[model samples]
Target: MRSTVSGYSALSKAHKFSAAGLVTVAGAAALTFALVPQAQAADVQSAGVKTVSLSAQEFGVTQDGELAKAADDAAGQAQVKAKAAVKAEVKAKADAADRERASRSEARKPMKPAAKPAAKPAPAKPAAKAAAAPVKKAYADNLDGWISESLDILRAKGIPASYDGIKRNIMRESTGNPQAINDWDVNAVNGVPSKGLLQIIDPTFKAYHVEGTSWNIYDPVANITASCNYAADKYGSMDNVNSAY
Candidate 1:
């Protein structure tokens, strides 16, 4: 009975030691889990801060106020250049129209019937050239005379309008009246009424006014010159236009 009791006591001691060992192992495992998470969390937070700082620096450099203003100024300069280019294109077109009119004037010269079919063709060309030279005519007050005078001026200025074209449009629009006005039309309602022989609106007259013509819309020469200039801008030349345009 004594030996059996002794054996039982030893067995109890062994079991207690085993349980203690297991508890130590469990505590170590718990500590490792807790410490590892803290270290990982610190690293993650540091990386997050660095990312945020870099983003802020990038925004500061790219979207700063001074840089933004510089970008806007460049855009404005580009716009100005574009507008100037458009103006240059318009000027080039007008110049081409003038050259075309001069060519046509040359072509319209009357030939001297080949100098009675006996003279050289070269002399005939010279005769045609002399005929093509503008003849100085006394300006008259009548519509016919006025149109003839206006054609002379157009020829001098290299404008491409013809007497027939101008006269036809004037007769249709204002019946040869220099002081004509459309007081009931859309232009009139807008306070920019069509005035003068060619039915020119006020804005059109102002924008296309010629250098030597009178400022008054009722002035015959002024109205015709301005109308021709406007036509040149709109349709290449007055000779190219017909009808209600």
Candidate 2:
């Protein structure tokens, strides 16, 4: 009886240990199945989120490229505008300079000379009259006139002579004759006859002939004046003569 009891006890303990091990194994299999499905679902969700992040990054890159292109286009348009403005300014200045030069050229043009006026005709003068002849002084054609004319000539020639002395000498020499001749005298014998009113020889008459009188020895006034001039020279004056000098 003691050996059977001991064997029964051993068998009971071995069976209980096998049953517990089997229960532990079944629970581990159920937990492993449930955790495997959850891990698969988490992997699918993570893949979806990674695909969205990649799409967003690609969109951001495309937007940055478009913004850069816009900025470059704006800079190019500004450069073209600046160049056009500069060209317009240069053309305006050139046009203004050309206008100024044309204005100066017009101002410097020469003016035409004025026309001259015509001259007027001169007025007519009255006809001129013939000039009158000069009047001559007259004297009588006689011995008294001859003496008076000789006295006038002597007075003009600054020769000193008196009427009484000249008449006395004339009466003694030729008796107041203009055509008288002393043919029988010593002067006549020598071929130089004493002739005229004062009976003056040819050589003596020419030597003492007064200017503005006739050269003819028979001219009464010429003979008397020449004789008076000669007598005045030799005797200081014809008035001092008292004889046939």
Candidate 3:
């Protein structure tokens, strides 16, 4: 029986040791699993805390994008400003040109004055008249005898020679003879036709012949009256009576 107890204790101890060893192994495996999880968490935290650094290529690309955006915005603003400035300048030039044109037009305009009438000249005055001359004595005395016979015949004719100068011219022409003839005539042969008293020829007799004288060339009253009428007609107012007959 003692041998049997000793074998049972020895088996019991062996089994207990074996169970303790199994529990230790399982605890060690569990502890390793937990430590692995903790190590992985610490590695993740360390990676998150590490500082990141960029390469030249990555930094240039980032700066280039920002610069391109800035250039685009500046270009847009510049275009707006250029358009506004161009419009303002064009408007200003047009206004200035219009003002200049208006100024030139005003300067070219014509000025006007009041209308005036033309004047007329005054008229000039007239000049004065001249005086008359006197008669002489020598010419009156030489003209006396012919004056009486011209008056006698003119009295019979009822038409007297009014002036003394006219009668003197008649006596000088025919000596108061009714049948007196000029010597240019002959009696019978080679006789040129002779004139009557006062030496009146065929032309004078025909020009002054009276209707009541009966064609007689020697009729004293008819001859004398005709001679007086001829003298008055030849001279104006009998003033040049001697030269007229």
Candidate 4:
């Protein structure tokens, strides 16, 4: 019976040792689970921090690039505007200079003379009229008219004589009788007879007959002109004769 009791005590001790080993293995497994979870959490937090920093750097780079591009564009636009302004100003100045030069050139030129008005044409003259016929002058029908007519003929023929001298000579020769004849005188002894107011012979009357007078020897105007012509030739004039010439 004692041997059976010892065997039972040994079996109890072995069961107690197995139970302690099991408890230790359980405690190690629980500790490993808690430490692995804490380590995984720390690694996740670090990866997140790195990811956030990289994202912030990329955003900054993009923003800087945009700002630089904007600045370059603004600068380019400013340059273009400035150049356009400068070109416009230069053109304006050139235009002003051209205008000023033209003004000065115009001022230096001489003033033009005023234009003269066109001359008016002269008026046409009227046509000349034809000459009219001369009117005959009327004289009295008397001895005075005959004497005046002879005197007018003598003046026309350029013969010079006086009315008083002719009348005095006519009164002495024929007593103012145009038809008287001196047939008994020295002129009558010849073939030609003296006749008319001045007693002129036919040959003497023909030789001294004035133009525009009657050819008849007894014609009063014809005889007077012919005798006066003969007297003017023989003597200085009929006015100097006081008797038969």
Collision pairs in model 1: none
In terms of lDDT, the poorest run of 10 residues in model 1 is 27-36
lDDT of 1 by residue, 122-149 (tens): 6444444445665656888978887777
Model 1 CA deviation exceeding 4 Å by range: 1-137
Model 4 quality (TM-score) = 0.50
For candidate 4, give the lDDT: 0.72
Cα distance off (Å), candidate 3, residue 40: 99
Candidate 3 lowest-lDDT run of ten: 27-36
**Looking at candidate 4, what is the lDDT of residue 35?**
19
lDDT (Cα) of model 1? 0.72
Q: lDDT tens string, model 4, 88-118?
A: 9999999999999999999999999989889
Task: Judge candidate 1 at residue 99 and give its lDDT.
Answer: 99
lDDT of 2 at 75: 95
Query: Candidate 3 at 245: error in angstroms?
Result: 3.2
List per-prediction Cα lDDT, in the order shown.
Answer: 0.72, 0.77, 0.52, 0.72
The better-scoring model by TM-score among 1 and 2 is: 2
Q: Could you give the candidate ranking by lDDT, starting with the highest? A: 2, 4, 1, 3
